[model samples]
Target chain A: MAHLDVSNVTKRYGDTVAVNDVSFSAKPGRILGLLGPNGAGKTSTIRMITYIAVPDAGTVRYDGRTVGPWSQQRMGYLPEESGLYKRLRVKEQLVYLGTLKGLSEAKAAERADYWLDRFGATDWADLKTEELSKGMQQKVQFIATLLHDPSLLIFDEPFSGLDPINAELLRDIILELRREDRTILFASHRMEQVEQLCDDICLMANGEVVLDGALRDVKQRFGKNTLILEFDGPDTFIDELAGTGRVRVNTRSAHRAELTLADGADARSVLDLALDRTDELYRYERVEPPLNEIFVDTVGEAEARRMQHESVTGTA
Target chain B: MNMSLRKIWLIVRSEYWRRVRSKAFILATLLVPFGFVLVAAAPAALGYLAEQNSSKTVAVVDQTGGQLADSLAAVSDDQLTFRPVSHPTDSVRAAVRAGTYDGYLLLPDSLLTGKGHATYYGMQGGGLTDQIQIEGRVSEVVRQQRLRAANATKGVLSILQSDVSVQNRTIQEVGTGADHTFAYTAIGYVMAFVIYFAVFVYGQYVMQGVIEEKSSRVVEIIVSSVRPFELLMGKVLGIGAMGLTQMVVWAAVVMGVLAGAAPLLALFLDPASLGVPADASSTAVAEAAGLSIPPVPYALLGWFILFFVGGFLLYASLFAAVGSAVEQQQDAQNLLLPVMTPLILPILFLAFVLESPDATTSVVLSLVPFFSPILMMLRAAITSVPVWQMLTALGLLAITFVTMIGLAGRIYRVGILSYGKTPSLREIARWATYR
Candidate 1:
């Protein structure tokens, strides 16, 4: 296992900076969630760490040495795009990929069979990739990524095409790999899975890192600003809070509502108002915001800033 | 090899074996020679069958008062039997219409004048050999009759009949090797075409292989394991090896056919009786005579392969870069014309090389790196290229191959990741120089 260190990595394509002044590092045997919306430089940063693209102004080091072909054997990457050969058999393609990643032929074949069976795809081992469904191909590709037993694994959008069951299967395998002390990093836009699976989370927007730290610590920094209210009454009280400057109601129903406290809002005063209006108040509490809300708020603010900047500068 | 090189070799090995196992490869390799055999033997067999079934019965009219008609043999070799028939021209036409005769030869009695036309009517046309035989017989009889009537001296008449033969000898001027135009031209075409065809055939393979990686998006995954350049090289060299193996199989089959089918072919064509070209190289003619067989040009063949490999690598590298620059096969179709121009140019100039292998234009073209692979093969066969020229051409070609590989590697590195739209030539060139 190896720690992946990426510092001040910047990549520019023509006039657009795809990755700008981004930095992230991972200790060995930990799952790091790389999160971003579209074109938010998540892939760019991960690509640098994987050594697929050289950073323009910073270094990507594994175990304090710069990444190169030697580092490749210790790393596995599954890019978002589907890549299995259509004409190749699942077993043969897996073995070929394993051998490419530094396994011996026999060892590759052995691991390939093992992984195929583990993924519940042994029955399709001899069948061509095209004969299998997209979900099945995704399964075989997942096996390919893990076939060489690399020290560090990187999966980009691993659950995109997977059915719920296969997604759960992948989640279990990733957790299993972590238990076996394999360092893992996966990038995705889906916040829930990241919240469920990550130990360290790095959120990016507008080619820059927006929020990154231990998952709990990042949530702690948000400081329980979300208000959850449930009561047996009409939902007018939720609307009454919507126009109020103290909170923004994210969702509402007749008897339940979730809201985020605006800056300088007092939760006690809000609770007092809710008690004043509602007869049977079943619940009223402030909780730490979910990763999804944080992600949307962060990305939305960054996008707004970019739009403002583009209008001010007259540039795209 | 080192670890990375070994990985590249794995790429090469898989690419080769994959194609080697393909049904297209097997069918092409196994069926082409048999096709050639069928094509070569079909016409000869059909002609023989037609000949055995055809027997022309020609009537002879005694319009010459037995002057020309008496000279013609009644049953001329059983191929065309001439029977004397006392019938007028109108009656002979009637017989011809009734199909009483296959044809009739009307000999006009112009008192032995050579100006009178002797008309032979036939239901159908004959082969060249048959026509020539009939023309020869008539001409010989007429000549003998004229000679007798002229009362010419025997020596004068005999000398008039003899054909003057010319012998060709080459005094070495600027080169060595055989001056047999047909043989040298044949070798030049073979060499030029092998290099041209092999380069084209396998170069596209390299391109398609790259497109495969890119379109499937395996390139990013692969680059994670090996450099983009390694993948490209592995593919280029791998596909080149496939083509080389196919060509070698074809060459072996050709040699086998040449050796094993000669006796069977000899039954159809007799070199001595049919009169092989007098000016053909004595070595080839001797073999044609079933005399002392000449040695194969192992050195020339070595040069042929050396040039073929150099050309294939250079073109294959460029083609691979083009493959990466495009997102789909349709995008690549537009890009191939420019890449194929250099390959096609030498072939277009092949005639120039054949006509004067030592001409200054030919020499310069054969020395030019882009044209050298094909044109030099032509020059080597037709004339003894200076050792310096061959080495210089090969050196320039090797240097070109290396330079192109470096450029192509850069293009492949970045272009593999850039998808969706095809880049312009300028954009692709920028990619080559990017990092």
Candidate 2:
């Protein structure tokens, strides 16, 4: 059974539909990327899942049953803007959070110590949170989230203030959690990070998921229209070259040009023709579309369609 | 342990340690005792030192050459050196304006004729004490002159002094319960003001704590793990514990100081030698005058802990709840007024009821749980309070404590995550009713 299944969820903030008909399933050993633009209903969905706010419509299931107090016990959440008491020491704050998550005093203290050591923050045990830098505070917050060893974890923009090294360190730790067969849901706009971490992805736009699937499958589907080319001279050459497919230049330089083989353009045949035109080509390879491009294309297309419909209805 | 119990303990620990260690709490706790000592002792200390080191010069301007000046000299504190001024009244005013003299008194010519009125020239609003001293001297002169004219004997003066004498004491046998000691009354004032102060200090600590969490959006993360009730209770209890610990330390310090200084107080204040006469009529006079022995310190201390904790928790919970309900400190003012009004009314009523802890006053203040702890402590200090009444007031207070927690929790649950306009009373009511 899936560890978490949020089905047909809808939430409204007064007249604003924050989350609209959202559905996703996070199975054990899987990291599901809940992707969205700012205010794109990702927080609303997470809030509903955590039971911080009740869903106006839909059910959030844990295992096979719907969410309940028992589910909340095993669920860990790191809110986007959460902070520790400014005057409280890092270790004490984590211990308090551990106790709140149902750890016994001894267990909480033990876990707090372990997490501090893991984050290389043992020396910071007695230092108030206010004394720690923003990156260090982020590490403490991360440790607090995982100290309880919750089966299902959700972190909203957990990498915000972290430096690259610490961010990678946190990423490795998240991957380690995934290796332990824990179900994780992370919301981030960093596509590269999401691509590296997520097993499945749900892309939310305008309070709705425009696209969702296994990460590899989604990338494969998104790859069909994109192509890469290597040739001498400028990109204007490819734009003028007639073909069975639409030619969109991906990149152009003094010595080489890259193109997307839109629709039916055979990459090898197109390259063969390009070879006939120039011989200075070094290498040409087809690669999967970057998640950022996919996001932009998908959200852009959806928005354009909406605008067209709105204009017809005089609501533009 | 269950989350509620664990969270509450955590909260208590958090509130206790965080606030107790705070410079603000330390400053506030120390402010009260220091303020009391300064207000009570500064004037006496200053006056004593002034008498020993410097003479208070008084300028006497006599329009008529009478023996009024001589009478004024007789009433001097020995350190008060009177300077006779034959100059115009304007000169005396200039001297006073120049700060040369504390004050000047102009005696009218008809002073001996019983139609005399004294014109005191100085800062009109200022020099009240100076005016009082001068008045006392003038009255003594008038009395002496009238007595001499009427040819009154010393027996008459003796009779007048004896007729107006007041002797006061407590009528209790050895130790029925205990007389309302001045010490006990002091404890009441201390306890009342302490509770008043501690509740605000600790409650504001809890309030600010909640506001910090709420404003930072940290409460959403916390409330996910713990119930609002546990969080509210934990904060109040923790801060209240810290306050009590500080209070005990301060009390111990005060007791130590008093114990070490008892002999000095006896030497200087003459307290042990200060006693009413042993006549039955004097005792009766003492009883009628409402004089009593000090309140039992141990009893008052016990009540102090009870009422202080109960009083602090009752208010602190509401304070925390209010903090949670609002996103900003400015919004908190809306919720703050209703909770504070009840507590303030009791404090304001303390003055009027101090002289008369009548049934009406006692019943009115004591029945209301908000006023009960402070008012009941006062009544208990001044007069006998029935055990049944105490129990009833305590029980009602306990119920009030529970009810406040319940309501505060409801508001806390809804308000912790709420932002923008402060919730109205109707909205809070709905939250309370939300099952």
Candidate 3:
């Protein structure tokens, strides 16, 4: 059962539809990646889910009840443009946010200490936020989100500022939260991170969901029609195939090429043709398209549809 | 619309602690009272120094050839000693130039017709106090001489020379009361100014606080857990409490300084030296000594707090709305002028309110919610205000503030999340109308 559900939610700002009939859910013990390009309504959807904003239409439910102040206390949201009070100490900042989330002062302090120790930030707990490095401040913000032990967590672009070491640590912590059966909504335009961490994915474009389901299912639905060829020699034959409309070239380089076969084109024939043209065919494989390709394809298709609709309706 | 008081309290506590611990808050809180103390003490200290330093001997060269010189010499005090000089005018002038005398007073002979003028020649001119003392003594001596020549009896002369002092009293329902007009005016003006400053400054602090949160992007995290209205109220209330704390500390400091300085000031000031009439009542003498400390108007203070809180909250919510609508403090300037106009307009009418508290203009202005905090306080301080007027002004202020908070909350909820160019007033109004 879904631990959090948003159904038929639509939010409009002035004449622009920021979120149009968006619907998605997060199940316990799984990470849901809300994937989108910039201005694709990912933040808007997260805002509605967290109750920072109310949907203009439809409902958001948590634990089989409409989301409200109760759900707010039980949820932790790290906004894309989130920050901490620059003049407040790390521990105090966490404690303040914890208390706002319904923890007692003493309990908030204890949790703050525990999280600070967990993140190896206990030494810098006394320092003001402004005194810390950007990565350290990001760690502090991450701790603030977990200090209340919220059942549902929402993080928007959580890894934008962290170094590799700290980012790895954050990834480990997020995985641990999943192990504890906490639902997570990770919203980002970073496709690689989403591919690595998300069990479920909801792809949005132009304020509408273009693709959504289990990550495996979403990939399978696209099929194994992509031909990845690694060869050293003339790649002129690959362009000839693309020009003939039998395949679409996604990427082309000196020694490698990625091509998506047409709807009825045979991957085996394309491979045989590639082998004949190349001087040395070092690698050849037929595989499903990567998430990056799928994301671009869907978003591009959605944009084309929107432009069509706008042109038809005489609206820009 | 589910609001949590606990969350609001948490926000308030954090906001309050954040500011109260800042070095700027501490400096601003303490510096104002320190300035007040310096202003209050400087003039009295200077007066004491001048009194100690001014002592001069003046030669009374009475060319009138009457008992004028003798009479002036007999009436000399420690600060100014008049010595009868028989030297010629040229030598007297030479003596003065040689520093043998501080100055020479020449009483020209005019055959008791008062046609010739009296002149004082000196190396350096005396201060105004010294000049008044010497001139008064010369005039009195001449007047006494002429009065005696006119056959006036001693009793008649005494009556002619004695000063008449008037005592101002106010009649009330209970009894007649001593008038402390000067003290009341001083306190009223200061209180009005303090309220005006507290409202304007603390309102700006709210704006700055909102801008800090929005610019820093912390507002998103905060609003997620707390309703925007709750957050807005918490900030306004928290900062208002901090301002009130500063006011309380200042009030205590002011009272302590006044209590400590009043006696010290009385010691330095002598009523007789100040030229108070010798035959005046003891109360008049005490007043002239500059030692009167009027009783604190507790009732007026209670009213002041009510208005200050109402006025601060009223402007603070609007300031917060302005803060949320803009990305930076500079962008808030155009919006701030309208919010600030109401707070500043009352100050312009402060003089009129103080001048005639019962005047219709003063009454009407005081009743205006925007102007009540300043004008009403001034009017109440200067005169007895009708209970209905006070209640009506407070009522209007309460309604306006509550309404403003509601409207501002709507604007703030939408504005804080918006980033980009500053919006216009029409856009803000449209935001307020959002469900």
Among all candidates shown, the one with the greatest DockQ: 3
Please tell me which model should have the higher TM-score, number 1 or number 3. 3
TM for every model, in the order presented, reads 0.81, 0.72, 0.82
Q: Residue B432 in candidate 1 has what lDDT?
A: 69
Candidate numbers sorted by TM-score from highest down: 3, 1, 2
Ten residues in a row with the worst lDDT in model 3 chain A?
A307-316
Q: Clashing pairs in model 1?
A: none
Q: Write the per-residue lDDT of candidate 1 for residues B42-144, one digit (tens) a residue.
A: 6655666666666777777867676656676632766766677887878887887799988788777773686687778776776775676667777777777
- Candidate 2 per-residue lDDT, tens place, A99-198, comes to 7788777898899999889888899999989999988988888898888889999988787767889989988999998889899998876676788889
- Candidate 2 wrongly placed segments (more than 4 Å): A10-17, A51-75, A104-107, A229-288, A297-316, B23-31, B55-198, B250-293, B296-308, B345-366, B370-401, B419-435
Q: For model 3, what is the error of residue B217's alpha carbon versus the real structure, in angstroms, after optimal superposition?
A: 1.0
If both were scored by lDDT, which would come out higher, candidate 1 or candidate 3?
3
Candidate 3, B218: how far from true, in Å?
A: 0.9
lDDT of each: 0.81, 0.74, 0.86
| Model 1 residue A162 lDDT score | 79
What lDDT is obtained when candidate 2 is compared to the true structure?
0.74
lDDT of 3 by residue, B310-380 (tens): 88999999999999999899999998877988989988888778778899998999999998989888888
